[model samples]
Target chain A: MYESNRKSSIVNIYLGSMKIAYVLPMTWACGGISAPLSQVNALSTRGHDITVFAPKDGRIDWFPLAAPVQVHCEHPVEEYFDAVVYVGDTFAQHPFSSAGQKFLLLQGKDHLWTAPAKRNELLQGYSDPQYHILVVSGWLADFVHGKCGNPRISIIGNGIDINRFFPAPAPREKFRLLLEGNFPDRNKNVIAAIEIAGRVRQHFPVEVWAMARRFTSAGELVDRVFLDPPSDEIPGIYQQCDALIKTSILEGFGLPHLEAMACGCIPITYASGGVMDFCKHGENSLIAGVGNLPSLLGHVLHFLSDSDLRSQLKDGALATAKLYPWNRVADALERAFAGGIEGKS
Target chain B: MRILAFTRESYPSNYPTSYILMHQSMALEELGHEVHYYQQDKHPLGLTDYLNSFSFDLIFLDLEFLRSNPLLRILSQYRRIEPIHIVGALYSLPAPPGPAWEVVDFTITPWKGETTSGLAAQFDLRYLPLAYSDRLHKRQSASAGSIFVGNTTGNKHKEAGVYLDELIGERSVFCIGPEFTEKYMDPFMLGSLYASSRCLPNFHYSWEKSGDCILNERFWQTARCGIPVNDYSPLMDEVFETGLLEHFCFADTRIWQNRIRNLNSGAETVHPALIQKLDDSLKEHSYKDRMKQLLDWLR
Candidate 1:
C-alpha cells in the first residue's frame, strides 16, 4: 500500500546490522500483512536480526522470509531491539513502547471506521510528534502531517516483487477479469466488480474470476473463486487475467494496481486515494469516473474491444511496477530508522 | 630504558588499536625495558603530573588521530629536556607526513609500498611486521572446520564472498564476525579458534590487492595459533620464502579442500618439523623481536 516516497544513503565504519522487531497486528490472513512482509523480508536478507511479534495468532508460514521471523507467541521477546515498528493499531494495542526507538507505521486509513472520535484518537496516537511516523503513501503522509497536524512523518511506500509477477506468457483466460482482495470487506466492493463482469459477459466472450480466502463463484456471477491461494499461485492468477479490478471506496495506497501491473494485467479503477499517485488515466491504467458506473463499465468494455490500447496499457503498467522494488522501500526504512535514532524524525 | 606508551583510551573489545597496544607494550616490557602505559583522555592524572611520575627515556605513541596535543604540550612544558617519541601507524598512513610528525622522532610502519614509502622518506621509518602477542601461545588442539575473523559489515570483504562462493556450502566454514560471533573474542578463544581451525582464511581490509599489502594483525594471530593459513595474497609467499610455504599457503580453493580432506582423514598432518621452523621464524615477527630490531636500528 506504499505510494510515492524516498532516497538517501548513509555510509559509516560501524557496519553491524541492528536488531529489529516488527510488531504486526496478526499473523492471520490479511491483505495488509503483505505490505510489512515485503519490507520484513528485505530487511532480514540485508542481515538485520528481525523478531516479528504476531502475538494474537499462529506463526506466519505463508510469506517467504530470508530468515525465520522469530514469531513471539508462547512468550514475550526479551532481547533489546534497536528499533520496534508497530504497524497501525498494533502500536496502540501492544506494550513495546519502552523497548527501543518506537515507530508507528500507518499503511493507510481504512474507510470502514465510522466512529469519528475513535479515528481521531488513533490519528492522535500516530501524531504524538515524539516518535517517528511512517506512512505507506504520499497522500496518507499529507493527510497525517498536513490535515491531522502531525509534525513527525516519513513516507515509506509499499513495494511489489517485479520478478515474481510478469506479463502473461501464455494467458489462460484472454478476456477474463480477476478481482483480488477479500470479498467480505465493504471498501473492496467485490459485488460491484462481480456485477461489472456480468455486464461485460452479456456482450463479449468473457469470464470473471474472484480471488479471496473464501468466496463462492456459484451465485456471485464469477466463473471461479480461488480460495486461500498459495503464494506461487498469485503470479499465475495475475498473468492469466487480461485485467484486475479494484472497486475500493477508500485505499491508503492501492497495492493491487502495482501487483496486477507486474503480471502485465491492466488495472481498471476509479482514480481514488493513493491510486492517483501511480495510475495515470490512458497511461499506466484506465481511470473511470468516481461513482460513475457508466464510465467504469465503458473502460472495462474498452479494454475488451481494443487490442492496441491493452498492449500499450500493459507495457505502461509493467514499467510502473518496476519502480517500487522491496529493496528501495527497505533503504528508505533504514534512513527513517537512522533519522529516528538521531532524533531528526 | 624507561618508555611511556601513550594511546587513546579504548576497550580492547571495541578497538583494534587497543588490542595492538597490548602486544606493543608487552614487547617493550619483554626486552627488560620499563614500559609504563598512560591512556590519554582516560585517567585523571594531568599530562605534566603523568610525566613527573617517571623519568621516561622514550615515549611510544600509537597515532590514530592527533586531536589533543596532550603529549606535545607536555613536551613543550620541558622544552629544555624531553625524551624522544616513536609513533606507530597501521591501516591508514598518516598521509603527507603532516605537521603531526613534527614532534615525532621515529615512525614505525607495517608494509613496504605507498602505505609507508612517502612517510619513510619523510621521517625515521622502522619496519615492524605485525607480530604474535606475548599473551598467545601455540596449541596443537583444533576444531572441525576452517574459520575467519573480522568485523563483518564495515570491512571490504570481497575475498570472503569469493571464498564462500568457491566453498559453495561444501566446506564447514565458521565466519566469526560481529554478527555471527560475539563482538570480539578474547585472546584465549581467538587462539583456540586458530589452533582448532584446519584452513584459516583471511582477507585484507584494504582492497589494494596487487600492491604491497600487509594484512591485519589477525593474520599473524592465526599463524601463532598454529593453523595453516589460506591468505589470498602473494605477500605470504614472498615473506615465508621457506619451502614450508608450499605445504601451508594454498592459492586455489579446490587444492585447499583436497589438503584439508587429507588432514581430516589422517592421511597427512601438518609437519611438526615445519611448524618448528615456522615457530622459529615467528620470533622474527614477534613484537619482542620487532622491538629489539627497532632498538638495534636506532643503535
Candidate 2:
C-alpha cells in the first residue's frame, strides 16, 4: 500500500510547507540575534512559515529584517509549529511543547555556558533526546558534544548577507588591522588584543581600527579608535581594512571574521571556536595559539611583511565567504526539520 | 603553633602571590611557630607523604594545594587526630567557597566587606588583609621619586601607567614589573627597590576584580618603608580612618600632585605618629595573628 510513495524524490529531505518558530532577543548590537535573523529571511522565501518571538514591539533600521519573518512576543503554540529554534542562552529558557523538534542555537561558549546556575545542567539539556544542538562551527560542535551528556549535535555554517558586505577602495599606507568588540567583556580578551596589536605596530607601522564599546582613548598603541558606529558602517570598515586581529580565547562563532572575510580581508585569530571553520590555517587566514603573544606576533608580522601571501589569502577568504549564502543555511535547516520529525515519530 | 604551609608556585617565590605566601610563612616562624613549607614545583610527593604521615597542631592550606589531590585528598582519612585546617590564598577570590570549603575550619582572604564575610560564615571565614612582612620595614637613607610595580602588557594597565606619569610630572617613576623586565625578584630584592622610591604608586583598573578594593600588599610595602601612596581607593578606609586624607591616602589627584611638588621642594613629611601607626598595623595584621585567631576558634 506504501508503494504509492514512489512519486516522491530520491530522498524526502525537503520539509514541504513546514511551520517553524524561532524564539530570540530583540538586541540591536548582539551577533547572536543578527546571525539567526539573516537565516530566517531565507527560510521565509523558501515557503516556510517563520515566526520570531521577541519582547520588543518596534524594529531598528539597520538589521535588514522584513516580511514573512513575523516578530511577536506571543507564542504561536496554538498553530502547532513543526520545529522550534531557541536562539542563544536567553531564549533557550523558553519551554517547549510535547511536540516539535527543539534546537538550541549556541553562538558562543565559556561565558554563556558557565554564567548560568550550573554547567552540568546545560550539558544535560543538549543530551536530551527531545533536543538537538545547531551550532555554526565544528569547533563549537566538538566542544558541546564533549561537555554534554548526549552527542546529538549538528554544524551549519552561519550564512552571511553577501549583498551588504564587499571589498572597497581605501587608504592602506600601512596595513590596517581591525579590532571590534565590547571592551568590558572578559571573553573578548581585549587586553590581549591590544598587546598583540602593539607588537605588530612597533615593527610594521600598522594602523589599528578599534571600534571599542564604551572607550575614551585608543591609547598610544592603537592608531585610531571610536566609541560607537552605526551597524551598517561595519561592512565598509571591514572592506577598507587589510586584516582582522582578534584575541578571544572562547567563541561560538567569531562573526567579525566572517563579515571581514566577505569584504576580502584576511583574518589572524586564535585557532579556537567556530570561526576556524572558514578561516582555515595558511589557506584563507593566519592562526595562532590563544594568549601566546610571541606566536600572535609571528602571524601578524608574516601578514604585514608578505604582500603576495596576503593577496592569495584574500582571494581564498572571499571564495570561502561565497560558499555560505543564507539560502544554503536554509537548505540545511529544511533537512533538519524533516529528519528530526522522522526520528521523533 | 605547629604549622604546615603549602604552595603551587615555586618555593623561593618568583611572582607576587608566592611572595605573599613565602613572607607569611617567615612571619609565622618569626612569631616562634614551627612552620614547614612544601611547594608543588619541588615537593609534590613529599607533601602527600607528610599529609598521610604527620600529626600537626594546625594546617595552613594554600587554595591551590587543597584542590590538587583527588583520591587521597581529605585530611580526616590520613590523620588520627583532628588538626585545625585553614584554607587561604592571596589570589583574587569570590565569596562562595570552593569544593573543599565544607571540609575546612576557616577561610583566610584579603576581601573585606560585609557581604563577602557574611556569605562565608558557614566556613567561619577570617579576613586576613594583605600586609607586608616585618623584614621589609627598614627605612632607606635616601629616597626619591615613585616606583610602579604591576602588569603593563594590558591596555588598562598601560593607561594607568600613563596616568601615573602625568601625576608624577618631571620626577622619575621606575616601573619594575611586566613589560619593564622579566627577571623575577624575591621579597628582599623587591623590598630594597621599595625603600629607594619616595612613594610606591598603583592604580585601580577594576574594583570588582580587585580584592578588598584598595587593601593591597602595595599599601603595606609603602607604609613599612615610610613612603606615601598616590591613588584614590576606598579599601584603605578600614585601616586609616582619622588620617584618611593626610596620612599617605590621597583622595584628590590634584592634592597628590601638590604633595609630590612639596616633596620635590625638600621637606620630609614622615611624622612620628604615622611611623607608629605603620608599626602597629604590621603587628595587628600579621599572618601569625590570623593563625592564632583561627586556632582560638577551633578550640
Candidate 3:
C-alpha cells in the first residue's frame, strides 16, 4: 500500500528535530496562508519545537494548528529559533531578529506588484545572501534562478492531508462537475471553467457545482454554488463531483486540485506550472494548456464517453494522492533545514 | 530596416489583431530588422512627435488606426521631407475609400475575396494571407481529440449553425471560445491547444464563404500543429493540396456531422501524405515567411 510506503519514506528521512519557527502571512481562507499552517501541523507531529509568528491583527482561524502562534505587532520576539523560515515578500520589510538559519520561502511571483520597481525589490530579496531561497514548485525555482540569478534553491512541494480528504462511498444521482477558486482573481481563470461548463451542458445533462470564498456575476452560471464552505465539508463536495475543473493560469502550488485528486475526483486542469509538480497528463489527471478551454472541454467530454478511462484515472488519482502525505512534506522541510545547518558548518 | 509598427491592443489580450502585431514584430526582429512598436493610446508622445523622434524606413500601420485627416496630414508631411514607405494591413475586408489611401504607398490584406482583391487591384493591394507563428504554433506529442478553438461570438458560428450545442452531441468536441472572458488566449497557450487536439473543426463567417478566399489564421495555425483542420471553407481548394482538403473539408451541417462521427469512431485518420503536405505548407506560411516576402517587396 502507498500509504505505508509514504510513511516509511518520511521515517527514512527523519533528521533530529530542532526549534523551527514559521513566519506567517496575514490570514485568509486561501492556500497561501494554509499551506504553511498545515506544514507546521505535520512538523509538530514529527516532534519539532514549532512556534508560529503572526501579525497581531491576522486571524489564524481558517484552520486549527498544532503549534502555539506568537502574535507580534510592532514588538520584536526575543526568543531564539534554530531555523526561522520567512513566508511572503515582506521578509525584508519586517525583519524578525532571530539566531537561526533564515529562509525566504518564495511561494509565488510578484503578482500584486504592477510596477517594475516592486517586482525588482522582490527579486532583490530572493537573491539576498542571508536567506536560502525555498520555493513550492519547480517553476518558482526556475523563476528565482532566471530572475534573481540564484542557482542554489530548494523546492519543497505542498502536501495533502490524506485523512482529511478521501473519496465518498456513495455516488450522486446526476453527473456533476466541480469548479474551485474565487471569481475575482484573474489568475484563477474561473471564467474559462464557466465557458467550458456552458459548452459541456450542450452535450449531456450535467450540472456545474462550485465552492468558493465568495461569488460574483459568474456564480449564477453554476447550478449549486456554496460560498466559503467549512474546510471539513470540502471533501464531501469533491467526493460528489466526478471531476474538478481547475482553470488557474498561474499557481505556485495549486492545492485544491491535489485535494480533489485525494477525494478520487479526477482533476481536469490547465497545465498551470505548479500543478505539474503532482499531475501527469493522461496519467493521474487530465491537463490541457493554460487558456486552452477547448482542450479542457475535450477532457470533460472524454470523461463522459469513456467509463474505463474514468476508472483508470480515479485509481491513478488515489495512487498519486497516497504519495504526498503531510509527513513527506515535513520530511522535505526538515531536510532543507538540515542542509542549511550543514552549510553553516 | 528600421520600421515603426502601430498596434492598438494591449499586451496579454485575446484579440487576433494583437497576435498579428506580436507575430509580425517577432518575425521582423528575427529577420535582423529593428522594429519600434508604438501604441498611440499608451505612448507618451504624440503620433507626429513619435514619428519625428525615430528615423523609420517604413511605417506598418494597422488599417483600423488609419485616421483619415490627421494621419493623412502627418503622412503627407513625412512624404515631402523623406521617402518613407507607408504600408497598411487591411485586417478586415471591404477597404473603405478615404483620403488616407491617397498618401498610402501600398496595402496588404489577409483577405483573398473579390471585393478585397478588386479593391487591392484598384489601389495596388497585395493578396497576402495571415500567417501562423512557427515559434509558437507547433505540435507536441499528446493524447488527441476533436476540438474547435476560436471566438463563437462572431457571425461565423451563428450563420453556419456551428454555435449550437447539438453539433457537439455525444462526441468529444472540445469547444473553447475566450469571448466569454473578454480576453484572447496567449499565443503559446493557443499553440499548445492546437497541438493537444487531433483535429480542429474550423468554421468561417457566412460572408467569408461566398467565393471569398478568406483563409483565416486557424487554417495555418492548426496545420502548423500537424493536425487535420476540418475546415468549412471552400477556399481550402485554392490554398492546400486538392485531395487533402476534400478529406478535411466539410460542406454543410450534415457533412460536418458525418466527419465528426467518423473522427470520433476512429474510422477517419489523417493520411501520411496529408501530414507531410501540412509540414511542407508550414515552412512557406510561417510569420517569418510572410515577413520575408513583405521585406522582399519593399526591396
Q: Estimate each model's TM-score.
A: 0.50, 0.53, 0.60
TM-score of 3: 0.60
Q: In model 3, what lDDT does residue B251 have?
A: 67
Tens-digit lDDT string for candidate 2 (B1-299): 55666555433334456556666765654565545444446431334444432234666665545554552265645443454555554255544335566556666777666556555665656667777666545567546666666532232455555455665356545555545543344344566677777666645555433444536676676666656565666666666655633656676666665665555445646666776775565556655566456556667
Backbone clashes in model 1, listed as residue pairs: A2-A157, A2-A158, B142-B196, B143-B196
Interface RMSD of each: 37.0, 17.4, 13.2
Residue B55 of model 3, lDDT score: 53
**For residue A198, what is the lDDT in candidate 1?**
69
lDDT string, candidate 2, A95-126, tens digits:
54543778877677533426345544565666
Better of 2 and 3 by TM-score: 3
Q: How are the candidates ranked when ordered by TM-score, highest leading?
A: 3, 2, 1
- Candidate 1 residues A210-307, lDDT tens each? 78876644474777888889877888888888888776655678888888989888889854467777887678887643332334565787788888
DockQ of each: 0.00, 0.02, 0.05
- The lDDT of each candidate is 0.67, 0.63, 0.73
- Which candidate leads the pack in lDDT? 3
Residues forming the 10-long window of minimal summed lDDT in candidate 3 chain A: A1-10
Model 2, residue B44: displacement in angstroms?
Answer: 26
* Selected candidate, larger lDDT, 2 vs 3: 3
Report the C-alpha lDDT of model 3 over A50-140, residue by residue, as the tens digit.
9888877787776998999887556555678888888886575556666578888877664333366775677677887777877888777
* Total clashes in model 2, counting residue pairs 3 or more apart in sequence or in different chains: 1
